[model samples]
Target: MGRKINFIVLTGLVLVCLLLGTEYQYLETAQGIDSGDTAWMIVASAFVLLMTPGLAFFYGGMVTKKSVISTMLQSFVALGVISVLWVVVGFSLAFGDSVYGIIGNPFTYFNFNNVTVSPNPAFSETIPFLIFALFQLKFAIITPALITGSFAERIRFRSYILFMVLFSLFIYSPLAHMTWHPDGLLRKLGVLDFAGGTVVHMSAGIAALAGAIYLGKRKEPIERPANIPFVILGTGLLWFGWFGFNAGSALGANTDAVIAFANTNLASAASMITWIFFDRMQHRKMSALGACIGAIVGLVAITPAAGFVTIGQSVFIGFVAAVVSNLAIRWHERTEIDDTLDVFPSHGVGGMVGMLLTGVFAKDVGLVYGETKTFIYHLLALCVVAVVTFFGSLLLYKITDLLLRMRVREDQEHRGLDASQHGEHLL
Candidate 1:
């Protein structure tokens, strides 16, 4: 099996190398590109890319010491897997010419043939189309990484790599096309996701839920976090990168970007406070874990509405989302499904709350403004996304399980993934 997998991977790499030879000409024009926006976007792209590693640390510290390295590697590997996939067909399937408003034509940007430094007026008029694609690629990279937390300790590393690739191409790409593309069905309905409440957080969260249900429980259901300091460092990095994640969605350095940046910080702050205080109300002591989770949930909840809502609304969004997700965690604990890190509660529920609140608080067309259309469409879009992501992910998991068996052997689980899967361990 190892030899077969290696052969398949190498063959694919060779095919990609051959395809690169077809593009003999380069696009050298930078017409109509704004230097200011371009510069910030380049920085924003890097900031967003940092988040996957941050997530690696964030998730790594929450598992048992034995599972730590494997957990972190799952997140870190997406930086390689998704980057390559995105450049090949993932970007085309997402932002290529619309195929019935549901998906993109894969051939439109095959091998990133036409994706160049020149501005694509349909997506962004100010920055180069290449920058926009790179920024969106970061979002894609972190998404499947987020799902790793759900089935963390017991999943086969190779199986996970396969699942990640499938999830990106089929599930994540369609959602991105539908939500972000100009000709997308959801976009036409005016479902506003300023950053990625719908595309990133919500999809990852629901898929996490599906994964937890599918994978069932880990052998050792309860374990202490491996390292709290790692969690803190991870949280700080996520928070810092999120400024780029949300603000950069504005696609230019303008008033909307400023507003999104402020709202991002304010929402996260409010959510952190709300999370810890709410824990106290529940007779649970406020801890570093609680604070970190709260901050992340706030970031997730405010993502869709980052540019569409005000600072006060963002605060409210964060507070409400934290409370909801906190309760969700409690409910999940009482159930049979073992979401290893509460990925669904923190990301899925938080995203749902954010998407709904964006419908309520979006500047002009929100429920608060007495415009029912946008809010109504948001509800519809949420339901649609939930069904597609949840069911689609389950099917993909089944396919992957058949192909490579998603879970490891019971003996392997007992030995810990660090040793069983990777042949490495912490000192």
Candidate 2:
């Protein structure tokens, strides 16, 4: 009886195995690959890519006409330089394996090996990893471009090139590594800069402050800004491109991206209305220029928190940010900082506000969604980043000056960077 039972069981096992093999083959034949996620990332990358030119115009219009083209060109040129560097080494350093809580290791992956479409395991499982690196390159390109506005029309172009090359390898790459990488020092420390508040704005802002101080004041008080109409056009592009900046940060075509998109608009609209009121209250008039500036300020402040906060919360945050940033810019004018184009006030101060505000408003804190920090964590992160970036940039400026004796000559400042550096004049 025992032998007969064993024989029946062995026969049944063989038949079950055969059925399982047939089903596996059928499933494979029925299903195919999906590319929806890939398409989204490509479109998102293109949108973020245009922001550099938009930035050129934004910073350019704020300078004297003679230096306007030069300021704008600086932004334009960085795009070409950073784009190549990004594909070659910048991406590897940013997304590579973390080394004792410092920078990344670059030897791994198809990166720098002259191969296209090497997959990264870091960003998202569904999206092609190359898409991940490309999206971030856009952010890296714009951060330093934004800083050019601070030292616009004054710094020598040759010095500027050296500064950018070093800035990308040393300053930008390491900060991005620490902030965004899964194993970065700041990320492990629980700093949540969703869309580059610390990495892009805080770093750029503090860097701008250091450059403003190191370069010394402009030869004359920034000739009361030229071309208000041009300023208006640039502001429009800034507002439009900012949608890509905040929304594409979602990285997926899902509900989170939609919420981020909506919040961006809410914050900017609220900022505009509130700023107009503030101007009317203080100066007894409503100015178009003030409204445009206020809207941009609001846009900057909401960036870090756009995907994390509510629409109502964004409205309040935007209003307060505009008021505070406006006050800061005015205060800066009174001081000796002389931040040309107000880069420090608008992007720097506004970003700081958004970073801290993200802590107050960041909603979910599930294991998958990442750690949820209260306000204290955000403040601590902000303080550490601000101090480090300020000193880091100051040291860089001193080193460059010591070696090359950089910074534009006084006569060049009087003549403008456009005429002196580029040998062209703005219309």
C-alpha lDDT of all candidate models, in order: 0.93, 0.77
Q: Which stretches of candidate 1 lie over 4 Å from their true place?
A: 21-27
Candidate 2 structure quality by residue, lDDT tens digits, 102-158: 677765432334212533446665565667778888998988898898888788876
Best by TM-score: 1
Model 1 residue 418 distance off true place after TM-score fit, in angstroms: 0.4
Error of 2 at 112 (Å): 4.0
TM-score of each: 0.98, 0.87
What TM-score does structure 2 among the candidates reach? 0.87
**Top candidate by lDDT:** 1
Q: Pairing residues by index, what is the TM-score of model 1?
A: 0.98
Give the alpha carbon lDDT tens digit for every residue of 154-202 in model 1.
9999899999999999999999999999999899989999999999999
